[model samples]
Target: MLTAAAHLGACAGGDPGVGSTNPFESQGNSNSMSGTTQPGSDTDSTPTVGGSMTDSDTSTPTGPGPGSDSDPTGSDPTGGPTTAGTTTLPDPDCVDDDGDLHGEGCNAGPDCDDTSFNSWQSCGTCVDQDGDGFWVGCDQYGPDEPGPDCDDANPDASDGSDCECAVTPDAKASDTCAEGMAGALGVIAEGGVVPPIKGSITGIDNGPGNGQEDWYWVEFPEAMAMGNRPNAGKIAATFAVNPGDPTSPDYRFEVYTACNKPAFEGLAATYGPGTPPAREWEFFDAHSPPNPNPNPNPNYLNNVPWPAKVFIRVIRVANDQSCSEYTLQVSRLPT
Candidate 1:
């Protein structure tokens, strides 16, 4: 009865074909089993069953088992969270205001123009206000900075197109001296003084008791107002003369370029004095030597001798009579 009961326990445990059937053999039929046996059944772990290892791929989920591995949704095993689009921030150290990276400085610098800070867009860069071609600073906007002067203090003053001044030309006026007894082209009186004329004691053309004459004189208003001449000789006095009577033997005319008549005392000294005295002429000759008029007609013209301050005189020869009408133009030539 004990042996039969023991055989019954072996059959209840498992099929006995693959292992020793002895109940107390220690190697029971149920215990001698492969890795595929039901749970709680005696079997070696999977590692010892086959010659090769069948490690379950944990990275790829096969089924819903706690120890079984492997992902089911095709998601990357090592992948982290996801992001979208591109980054959009300027590099603080990057001088390039725009990411393009050109110009004087890219990263680690200031923008050339500040008002328009967009680095890649237009309207950015230092500009010359004066148009001198040099940039003012890192930027062209804001306060008026130093550069080419576009507008100076004066609205009309600037370095612009129409503000350039013309340079003076190289030239000078030359000095000059006058000639002897030669008259220059007369310049119209520009409001100066007249020549000196004084003293009256005439008895040459008239015999002592018959004389009354019309006379005139001239002088420069100022020494500085005289015009310059190209030559260096003394200028002579010139007069235009007209005699009214062609047949009056006692009729005569005279003038003195000097300040006064000669020192001699007589009728001749009174009218034809050689050296002029201090104050003024008593009487002097207007006539030059031996008919100074080359064409001695009644209407001929004459050039008088140049008068030194005290060395000139004039005279006229005529019979005893009163003087007649005449016109006289006198002038000093330039020196």
Candidate 2:
């Protein structure tokens, strides 16, 4: 049997199984290891005895293992598994700021007047500071007219009409369509004196001649003479329709004692106080009583000097209508 076992061990190719099955085999056959696995385990997972532990295959390993520094799946040093999630937070204040409806910060975009709710869309900011009952929303006032000035006080006055100073106790005159005068002459005082009433002044019908018949008149507070009139006095009046052609219509102005009586004062107080009639009539025209025009009468200047009380009238005579256009004037004279 021993001889037979030796033959079997020698025929088993020196494997551990054949060697372990017959220990009496020849020394050459008994050279095989006792067991293929280590003494503690049934598997040969550990490195083989007398075997160099060089990596057998270059292919990646399947799972986690010991003693291996390289990763199974990849050759990179940072080849670990990775996880992912949101990296940033949404901004609550972001909105369409540029008026273009794109999300952006308040001051970063084209929102000029962003503080205003409606102004966020760009354009101009519509705000009306004055309460003039006028709605100036985003738009401007009239072409020549600008925004309201002196907004704190009178807004209507901001338009520029209330620039001049004020006057007290003024006088005014009026007449019907048949015969009417736009303005009247009167005396005014500084502190105690009253100014002429404020009234609209306009020139009579265009006249070169043709008996247009425009009457000019004046008024006195109590019908007093120049001596009794106050020391401080001024005249204010406005005129229209100027004679474009001087030669066309011969024009002149005249002054005379009021004939008979005016509708305002009764016939009782019509005449001035003097001799043959208490007071005599005077003319400011270039003719009669001594023509006032320098060409016709050199003494015209001396006739009705400044600061004189008189009734005046304007006359025109020519082939066409005639009168020089003039603006309203208010001035004080040296008494």
> What are the lDDT scores of the predictions, listed in order?
0.27, 0.28
List the lowest-lDDT window of 10 residues for candidate 2. 1-10
Over 26-75, each residue of candidate 1 has an lDDT whose tens digit, in order, gives: 22233121111111111111111102224333243244457646545343
Shift of residue 175 alpha carbon in model 1, Å: 41
lDDT of 2 by residue, 1-335 (tens): 11100000001112233323322122232311111111111111111111123333334435456887656654335544433323332333556532322235523334444333333332343433455533223222333324423221234534435423232112233231122344355443322222322322122324322333333455433233233223223332222232322212123332334434331111111212211110012212222333222544332222222223334333332212111222222233223
Model 1, residue 328: C-alpha shift (Å) = 1.1
> What TM-score does candidate 1 get on C-alpha atoms?
0.21
What's the C-alpha lDDT at position 71 in model 1?
A: 44
Point out where model 2 deviates above 4 Å: 1-211, 220-242, 246-250, 260-309, 319-332
lDDT of 1 at 254: 31
Candidate 1 residue 132 Cα shift, in angstroms, is 97
